[model samples]
Target: MPLSSAPISAPIARQGDGADPYAWLQARDEAEVLDYLKAENAWQEQQLADQAGLRETLFQEIKARILETDLSLPSPWGPYLYYTRTTAGDEYPRHYRCPRPVDGSHEADEAREQLLLDPNELADGGFLSLGAFSISPDHQRLAYSLDTSGEEVYRLFVKDLDSGQIHSLPFEDCDGSMTWANDSQTLFFAELDDTHRPYKLYRHRLGEEAAHEVFCEPDGRFFLSCLRSSSERQLILQLGSKTTGEVWVLDAEQPQQPFTCLAPRVEGHEYDVDHGLLEGVWTWFIRSNQDGINFALYHAPQTDHSVPTRADWQPLVAHSDTVMLDGVTFNARAITLSLREGGLPVIEVRPQGLPAYRVQLPDAAYSLYVQDSLEFDSDRIRLRYQSLNRPAQVRQLLLDSGEQRVLKQTPVLGEFDADAYVSQRLWATAADGTQVPISLVMRRDRQGLPAPLYLYGYGAYGASLDPWFSHARLSLLDRGVAFAIAHVRGGGELGEAWYRAGKQEHKHNTFDDFIACAEHLIAQGVTRAEQLVISGGSAGGLLIGAVLNQRPELFKAAIAEVPFVDVLNTMLDPDLPLTVTEYDEWGNPQEPEVHARIKGYAPYENVRAQAYPATLVIAGYNDSRVQYWEAAKWVAKLRTHKTDDNLLLLKTELDAGHGGMSGRYQGLRDVALEYGFVFKVLGLAL
Candidate 1:
């Protein structure tokens, strides 16, 4: 009985409907759970078309055991220019003939006719051409951002990858990510206004007729902005959230001024601007709230008036419990430091302040990144390893004597063996005693009979899910299934008290730490509860719909990708657009006591019928952030209050959005149809 002390089943919990604190979890609220999810959305879309025909017959028997096993899905971008999909006299039988990054020279087949074009001619001219480009230093011009749907918004175009001509962008809620300036003719991005919120920060000067506001984000608070630079008229901002922040500098030719903080609004601080020299010497990174006496690399030195002067700073590396920094490549006489320290990832260097030569990394979850440098003198170094049966290896090294030089290798499955599968990481405990962390992976030959498991988690925004290594999760651990991952709770890996014990009013401690990491792998013997299943996508699909509505007898199947189970009508809609920046990570559900603690985990208003398991949800009709009709009305009211014969699949996709697939063999055929519904609900046989 040690697996997180299990024991909550009083009809899925109860006891406090007042003294407020989430009515101490008495349950049933929010306009009677949005009127029982609007009266079971049309009988769960008619039993989700027979659970999508048993997930397309377990994805054509795992694509016929991955086409009778030869297992070669590589792709880390090495073996320059290689892609093959032909059937002899191919008269267009599912065509695939890509080939371009060659250098076996003789002018490498005319540099593959000037770098292989055709992304369907930029999607037949309506735009999507990011097919060829590279400029961003001080050259000014090179941009691309498309996704016409997934909830419709991202559009930015701009291209001059040396006069090719495009220049789109007409203004719309850009929603996060974009950076380039050092005279790359300005570009920085972030948009939201029209009351969808997140104040603008635009810029577009290749011809410009419109594109202003260099910063706004305020209305009712929420800012997680990001942008970086060191030249082209200075810039380096980070804004806040995820527990306080603030560190400005902006100046792109002073666009209305007011943004010179350089680290102040602190509150459980967190900074990082890394490289330096817009006005001179810089290299940031802080963590403080005090504990491990952080600062794993700092340097400042700009002075005069841009802030940052702790006597012109300089710390450069400190560790305890582990550093793990990874980034900060500078070099005029040394500064390398990639980090990860004691679990692998090396490359120390330092110089001028001493400390040198480290290197390591034969593989322990690897990565290097410093690509190219000469005048500033750093000399190559991209690396990027992969294990759990190797798949992505990307090379470049050279760094004085690491010598490797591959380039790209992602076959995306040509055959599959991945060292016959095997991985581990363990550390369970959950149900209050805390400690969770799993990892798993499978098929190293084990008769753990009911072998199907799947498990996964996201908890909430603090995002942690680490222990990287995958070839599309070795095509589901080469079939016999297994996968794991948990690390539960408002992640941040055991830091800020495991993300304040899992967010807002301690969000049911992230669904009781993902059911005590799936009953600690069915009590450590490995897999059981009818061979579990569980899965997560988007807030880990609202942590697998809050553990299938508070544990429906453990599991036998589930997946919720793109899930947020209409959490109390999406935090009581603040005119939806990332719902008022997720009211400080899920809370303000129009307050009647945070709408009675978000309708006690609104998995489409908690469907009942007792024994409900077999599921599959997917969604993405251009997901405007979890809204494929809230996983199509929670698989239409869990197939109208499911009781037994459970099975409620739903696919949707409808031309992707919210990252469903954008190349790479259509996201491995939608992750081999969600691992063929976790090997046909644990019956396993692919």
Candidate 2:
């Protein structure tokens, strides 16, 4: 591997107004900015040139563990059973369908498969993401959205399954979300503004020349989304901000009628509604957080075609201080409540009039995600379960008996053995005496007490970072590397209170909590400071930057992927896509107090002239969520300020966006590159 970097260029200054010297880098059309990015890319490639063999070895090791030609477990929907399959050398999965058994049974043995959609065909050797995949209620038509430029804007297309014919809408900035009315001829879709916010809702008739705007959320703080209720009786529209929301519903059968408000917007109150006869009445079952930090379940009658507020809601499940009611799903036979208790995921089932029971998984620390029940009236519910050392399994849970049968368990090929790994839960006390949870996994054959460990964290947006199994992670584990995830505050794992404690004015808690976790690992003999590596992406990348600035001596190296480091500048620019929408989460930086708080720890604003650790920064040229310039500008500032001969490299993906490289094979290559970086810095052999 290349030893260290040579001198790099300083950031380009924006001539006049702004406080940022690298503000000019955000100008996409500037040749000078492009040249700078290209130069950095060239430098990064040159630095890693000697690791080509190691990269390939890691890539092949990961590939060897995956079953190349495999098909997903078939799911029955209407008259068909749907599944996706990958060929030995295909870049993407091919979706296929077959008719279910004639006697209304979920049998696929006699079914003949029919090819429907192949992303490989649509991608044409470039990036392609399916934003929306909706089949009409009548099951006669299909509407799908595609974004091939990695820019996040998608175009909608409709297909006639019977005739195998297709046509596209004229929209270029569609939000890639659409729902069909009961009539099947009418479809509702959200439209994205120039800032990439889904601000307007539109209605289109199957054969119409144009779609007309039906509703527009003028407030940049809220985004509009719509979906047909499971009852298939109403089309529900929600306008949601980070902390406040409003709900509206229209009769699915009456497509031209205006949507009636279910609840008016109230600050500090967030709730979601669904159409169901939960109490043997046509009611709206709501998962709301009005009286408690952890949400509760309530049901309100559809009273005389009039809007009902919180006063009309009757509690079905009272809010509990220990349990966070994350979501509620209803069907004829059951009402499922997704919850998080004691920092772990739980699935609760309430059969019509029967007692509630939890669907238990075997693992001590694993993630449980409930899938949408394709057959809503059926007695069985489907869910997926996995952990850091376990491959995911799709299971069919029998609601009546509380027994689950595995429909399909993801296969890990070659010499993979689940019993050869150990997954453990550890706790680290934060500066404020709060115990942060850490999920860790390593090989059972390890001979050393302090192994080379990789610690990952993300503490923002109430988004939990689950300890998921990675086929590529085995490449590190087999070589005696351990991986752990710090479940710090700002994540939903421990409930709303945990999330609130790590966001806005309390954002510093996130960084401090992460540092505590790193120190705890060393103190417990899990890993030595020099053998430890830290990493996070996006907001988590912000965590990496802040902690590194505060205690650069705590880690051997770091990786920031498509990081959101220029927080103060980006959050202050209200014109940015997610800036205004995220006010409740990050606080409005325009306010004096909020501005000062953000500026205090915003990574780009606080870079100091000190010895820094070896770092690898990844960026995407077309990322709409976190702009590419954030990474570029931060790297430029770091290079100019840091007084170290350590490795600092920035690699930009020219063809992809926020999620980095697309396509399965290409994604593996990306992981290989990252693994190579870790190996190089830690001085590990391939």
**Candidate number achieving the greatest lDDT relative to the actual structure:** 2
- Runs with alpha carbons beyond 4 Å of true place in candidate 1: 1-239, 248-271, 274-301, 304-384, 388-417, 421-479, 482-532, 536-541, 546-555, 558-584, 591-601, 614-686
Score each candidate by Cα lDDT.
0.58, 0.87
On residues 1-686, what C-alpha lDDT tens digit does candidate 1 reach at each position?
01111222101112234332122211223443333333332233443333466555544434443322121221212223222232322211121112333543211232342222234444542322131132355433446565444444566666653456676767666763556655566666777665445456666555666767766757444564555442234566666665565667765555345566666664655555544431234444343332342235655655445666444445556644545554556544555666544333456654543446765555444334454433343344455555544555566555545457666554443556655666666777876686776767787885456576778788777555655666556556656667777777686554444666788888888888889888878988788888888888887888788788888788888888778887887677676556766777777877788788878777767777778788877766556677666776566556656778766666666566666755544555577666655665666554
- TM-scores of the candidates are 0.31, 0.96
Q: Candidate 1, residue 27: CA error in Å? A: 14
> Model 2 TM-score?
0.96
Report the lDDT tens digits of candidate 2 across residue range 336-388.
88999999999999988788999877888988888747676778878988999
Count clashing residue pairs per candidate: 30, 0
lDDT of 1 at 587: 73
lDDT at position 598, candidate 2? 91
